[model samples]
Target chain A: MPTEGHTGRKIIYDEDGKPCRSCNTLLDFKFATGRITSRAALPERAGRESRTIPAQELIPGSKSYAKVEPPDVVELGNSSWNLLHSITATYPSKPSEQKKAEMKQFLTIFSHIYPCSWCARDFEKFIEQNAPKVDSREDLGRWMCEAHNAVNEKLGKEKFDCNFWAKRWKDGWDEN
Target chain B: MPTEGHTGRKIIYDEDGKPCRSCNTLLDFKFATGRITSRAALPERAGRESRTIPAQELIPGSKSYAKVEPPDVVELGNSSWNLLHSITATYPSKPSEQKKAEMKQFLTIFSHIYPCSWCARDFEKFIEQNAPKVDSREDLGRWMCEAHNAVNEKLGKEKFDCNFWAKRWKDGWDEN
Candidate 1:
């Protein structure tokens, strides 16, 4: 699971040298020229080297499909944060012990199965270090905010006002 | 939890008249005034109705805050579908039985905790009828495609060509 922002490249070779289920693409894995670093081997000059390429590459006759695409980090971060915040916002206020256990297990499994390799690793490390707070809604919500802030910090983005979780996820802004 | 498109109205209330943690926004189970048919009672002339008043109402100066926000179904659906598709696209081809079991359990729990009440119910029903096929990567991926297609049909969207799971998710196009 190569993470985003890594300069090193990884290969996904199949024993039969066949197309893999990695996003259903037939990645040659090794460059046609014999190395993972060759630019000429790519069907699209992917902006990122994550294992699964974006689906737009599969579209026919789309000349600039690769150029306009957002980098993997941006898309992954946006999608991940949106889902995670929603989950936290919906956490029970005073969850039962079983509920708490289920949530913890969910996070652990989520980290393992998450799509991006490096992002998943980072999440697992964060969970190990901070642990999830599932006993109450408030605790889980705050922990989620903190977890997101940590990612933001890594990406050099400004911290969100955690108090505004309700506004950000549950309520529309004042103008709305 | 109200689903999308019921009289086009959504409901977010619990039987006990307490917020049921469907995404954690505090939905007043009933309106200040009665008559479930009063669209005029809505703060924002909501396109659909579900209980959670948007947090804008809680802001310091929002005298009319509760009048405007619709329930969170649309956003949740968009976000959730994006992530789940991604997850299935990247599933391992030869998953172990334990891995399969975990995935099934995860979906069961996910349905229960999902924010919208009616949407969750629909999902549970879908699972009960179809059941997940996590025995192999292909089975699970196909199941995911069908599950998503079910939602798409409800929303009146065109059915995606399920054959393109690899192309849509794992691989870029043939040119890639």
Candidate 2:
């Protein structure tokens, strides 16, 4: 079946002497009704030829052929993932570097208060895991809550006052 | 109460000479505890004066404070209310340039599909109304689905197809 003009001919091609590819009919005459009116059957000799062609073996000039290059692989110490992941696992991406550094500085300011070794370790691990997810500086409130809770749980301390976390993060604890 | 330390000596200043800002009690020795500690109460005169300082104002300076800058005003032009509304809205101070570019590109592509007509007006309106709340590129798919569905309904066309949207995007039809 012919499928040349699915949505009515809208003058896609200029009217000179171009033949329609599907119908193989001359499209030189302008129709008074402004509609496609001609249709043609395949020529006898043209109908005998095999149309199937393997895609890979087809002409290099064909649109379907594309030269794909293999992706680059980077080795990270023992295992290989990608350079970005390695960097992030170690430190953080450039965008989050500031926040990471702030957390480190905040840790430094409050270092004296966190006397219990276990509490400190747990707090660091908790912050490292959660800080990158913080979208805004205000999100530090949530981080402090989680860190305080984690530390208190680790040290077997009764729910440490939330004020300790909030005050330390806020005041930088009398940097004198 | 006597806020001072041993020997009736003002415990405010201990042998090591480190005074606790909170209680004004002299610290005996310093240790790198690596965690926040609670300060003991200080003498009335000093403690009352210091407590008045706001915690938010005392946070140590970080890159967030240094880097945060006001956003430039964006002007909306002839487009869907969604696109216009998104353009006119304020974004976070630190929105990544890539994100803004992607938004601009999406709007550009959308403009081509809706073109300069009322047909795309609803999509523009919808996007503008919703863009501020969108946090990531993945969220855009949902917005597009809803916006396109609304536009299609308004135009009396078939339901918007994601495949068709992708094809139109790939073909660069809406880019113009």
Candidate 3:
């Protein structure tokens, strides 16, 4: 559905056909709406002297606001990793034939359709090169760790020790 | 793999433990591991003394510091919905037979394996009652809106109007 602004008035396009000053890519559309609604919950300009702040400007590099709240790219990426690893941790050690097939299919499709488009595409290609191993959950988890490390390696991040799977995700860490 | 704590110490289980006092359910040991790690991230001693706060407690509602934050159910759910609706918006208006079947299968398996277990279970039942329609993108989008509304109704949230699909996700709102 077309999202509504706070007021009842309909949003409209710019008649001047000027490029958006802030982001000057090819004006994506020759004719388009100028009512720039935002998904980010930035504040609205209240008084005549007030100026609108672009979401990007209010971010880390802004120098105006450093300690912004949660759910940024890095945090979201980590959360997704935590979730996927937990799922792998819970994967059946000895899956049924149907379950194995389902898991394999699920991973293949997941790589294609993850929300991060470029990341999804890269993972799809990676999967093609290294097809998933679904024979057992151990194999799957190990492979997943390897897969994650590969992504980390590409991004210049440190690799994780795959051997710690049980400690981190399943069994409690061995304190002794 | 065992996870290590920040101190490089491992977390351990009690040698001869009774059920944990905090959580009183029967130790699901026959088919479980009393490894008993918690995901909640609540502080150990929320409101007792000279302040040492776990990151989890700084979150709102947390007693210690109340600012701990990660994507909770609400944020994750909304992000998931955004991804799903965007996917539907991009689905081929006139899909090939293969594409149609793939999309249908994708939705079917998605409901079964979504990360939120309870949400997945509820969606599985919902899909059984309302089989998906994938004849065209419009059909798919409408189906998604209806399915989302069903969930919203269950959660006592407002229903979205399906008529403005293009205006919202695809073509920014048409002001004229």
Candidate 4:
């Protein structure tokens, strides 16, 4: 029962079932990279099974996996780990185009109301927790109104007063 | 001179002038739940005069302040240290829309290449550090190509033969 294994650089198989690459300690092929190669090389099961193909294969009109131009491998060792972590940690759950547009609009309109990151995050959380559950735009509007009012009350000001004041004064309001 | 400060539910002024609101200990004001009283309350001189505006005036449309709304005030209060750390560590740099779009595109493509969080983060860091400063679309394409190549080499297959490949393959050799 000879099994294959990897010793850092190249794939190797031992005749005496040794684990340690240098001293030939009894090896564990269960965790060996050669095990992966053997598993991959196993004969395909009979019949056309619905294969859970890699995402690359799922992409229509994609060429054979062997022929495509390879991504730069130099950075792949640690770069892939970095890329995946950053992407997932910061990934926004998929949203509709309309919702994204709305989010952007709100971000712009409420930009001043939330000058600090904490406040902005709070507002975003409030929207996420409340907006989707609401049934109608009217409800959404009311929620926003209440939220705006709540923030205003906290800050000791009336809602929409800034806009009103800017309109009335018409002279000194700095355009953001 | 006593300065008025709001302590949760009540407004209190510091009579002792003991730097109660130092740059670091100003989390109370930073995460305050007050309404935006007036953007006008912010002094124009605040922006021109200070590198960091007083935490009190960071309201939207204010002369020197901007507002940030977060989902929860309590978490904000507790986590203010980390948030402030990020604020102070990075210079205020606004990414262009083009850069934003490219980043988004890169993330979308990168997600498929390295689904694991760790791998994705590493890849993103590689791009951030090594990719050319993207001022134009041409630069973005070049960076994408470089990123693509970087990931391909890591899996030990000829660049672009793995499960997460991204290059387009031509049809002469494979078909024959």
Candidate 5:
């Protein structure tokens, strides 16, 4: 059975017939996929009502629950955002032409090879709609912030103020 | 004034003559750089003994301490690793030639555009020494684990067992 991701794309399956982990959230791929039909598969949640376990916690499994747990889509997405924002935060304020070209190239390749197929496709479309402005740190920072806000909006999360991209990613706020 | 990063590279300065945030940890760039000379600059730490504050906590500045804080080298590096490892975890078990080439291109671009100059240089050198092995998921995962272990070893951190790359990055432990 195939699962449809948030993007409405049918998640691809591995040789084992498990849905691709990178294309779907752990919830859709793990619990909702009917793979854990046996109560024995979820020892921690066996005796407890499913509602008691936070969805996020249930997916990653607490450290005590698993010795080593692979990151789900959410975990991967958040960390990737951290890295991307940090990159823009430190971008040269006045980049050389070569630097600008390289930055654009980097983004293009990043969008192509991002682990999350659906997420990457969405981002590629986003880039097509709003081409990266890599002329300066400010341009890049605002562009990335806007990009993040788009995701946030799609996820029904609160959007960050684009005005404070620098304060959030580069300099500490004055109040500190 | 310029400060030296853990990599021993002289942290570059911006037009304002402040040390580069990406090249140095927040400790070296923020407190140790002498830029925060006045007591007012450290509103939270001013009244207390510096020893009471954890160094990592001090660099990130608690949300209560600062409205928004940029990531230092440590924060950026950790997040970047999370993204990198996740990429390898989801990489195809038997990839196409195009996938292999694209992955290599992504790594090269990532090395060039990584926010931390010193860290990027080190990674570039590492890549040259050990070219990426992207033929299969197993090969790529082990290669990435070894690469991360190299950095971990340099930082005096415990090394991960490369044999368990799938357990750590893709499949949740069976014990879970």
Candidate 6:
């Protein structure tokens, strides 16, 4: 039987009956499926760096693959946010009708097909509640910042102040 | 007058007549606009870490924002590739018709509004030449790898072997 995820939604499983890798944190999936050999072997957290198996353990000719661990939920989220924030940072202050429509459509499709089922559902709900503000760069940046803060809060991370979204994502911090 | 970009596409400018940050590399934009007073001040490359202004230069109470530099073309590309590969890594081996359609739409829209105008155009052309294969996880992963390798070749970077795409993105390298 598939396990109930913390989100109260039933966690999805693959055709092989394995818990969906993208939909659950690595440790939670391992524990729920009884893959962990012992409690002591549990990682401190599901961080990419912490879990990366050394390249020496890999097959020959794979030395170049060092530190290239498959992403867990946290790592994937971090990379996705980096791309999302950067995209908005460079968005035109005054976008054309086509640009605005494309951005809106991109976000909608992204929310629907994101690999993490539960996380995607949460984001879809968030978008429904706070529609994307794509009229201008500033509006979109602030909206993205707020959206990120919502995720941060859910993940128990620090919330970034939306006022500095532009500085953080665009125009580098002032030097001198 | 706005400068011609390397891709032969006219570089876009914002309403302020400034070169679009997302359309050209930071150093290229700076140089074309004569924002760089001296060639010696030019960065080795448009890397996020290479050009991050120290937190000490930022406003007070912003020390926590260290290392959060505005992304340049290279940085944005790196993050975007990470997200794209990870998404494909977690894709279902056998997807529903709805899932396949959604994935295709997501990639098409992504290719349209990918922030970097020239890069987006190149990706759009690549997609036109090689339609996204969404029939299975393996198909999608290979397609994404080839797409990334196309960009890598264009940028003079080493190509990743597609044979190990699964090991690099889906399963961890074997340990012991």
In order of the candidates, what TM-score does chain B achieve? 0.58, 0.28, 0.59, 0.27, 0.61, 0.65
The window of 10 residues in a row where model 6 chain A has the poorest summed lDDT is: A20-29
The C-alpha interface RMSD of every prediction is 12.6, 26.4, 17.6, 24.0, 11.9, 11.6
- lDDT of each model, Cα atoms only? 0.58, 0.33, 0.53, 0.34, 0.67, 0.69
In order of appearance, the predictions have TM-scores of: 0.59, 0.19, 0.51, 0.24, 0.62, 0.64
Candidate 1 structure quality by residue, lDDT tens digits, B12-85:
33344432222111122122112233434435425433455556554454422233222244445655765676
lDDT of 4 by residue, B64-122 (tens): 43342211111221132122122221212355665455445434443333323334465
lDDT for each residue of candidate 5 in B51-84, tens digit (9 for 90 to 100): 3544444325232222534654555776788789
Worst 10 residues of 5 chain A by lDDT: A57-66
* lDDT agreement of model 2 with the native: 0.33
What lDDT does candidate 5 reach at residue A47? 53
Write the candidate numbers in order of decreasing TM-score: 6, 5, 1, 3, 4, 2
- In the range A1-176, model 1's lDDT, one tens digit per residue, is 23211223233322344311121112332332133444455444354434453665433443222322211333445566666776776667878888898889888888877765567788999999999988887788788888988987876665666676665654435342
How do all the candidates rank in terms of DockQ, highest first? 5, 6, 1, 4, 3, 2
TM-score of 2: 0.19
Give candidate 4 regions above 4 Å deviation: A1-176, B1-115, B160-176
Better of 1 and 6 by DockQ: 6
Question: For candidate 1, what's the TM-score of chain A, rounded to 2 decimals?
Answer: 0.57
Residue B72 accuracy (lDDT) in model 4? 18
Tens digits of per-residue lDDT for model 2, B1-176: 23443323332322334332222222211111112122343254256434543435433442111111111000011112322222222222344765555454445434323212233355567666756234543344445555656755654555544433322211112221
Answer with 2 or 3, whichever has the higher TM-score.
3
Q: Which stretches of candidate 2 lie over 4 Å from their true place?
A: A1-176, B1-97, B108-116, B132-134, B156-176
Please state the CAPRI-style docking class of candidate 1. incorrect
Rate residue B23 of model 2 by lDDT. Answer: 23
Ranking by lDDT: 6, 5, 1, 3, 4, 2
Off by over 4 Å in 5: A1-66, B1-66
| Candidate 3 vs. true structure, TM-score | 0.51
Q: After superposition, how far is residue B138 of candidate 5 from its true place, in Å?
A: 1.4
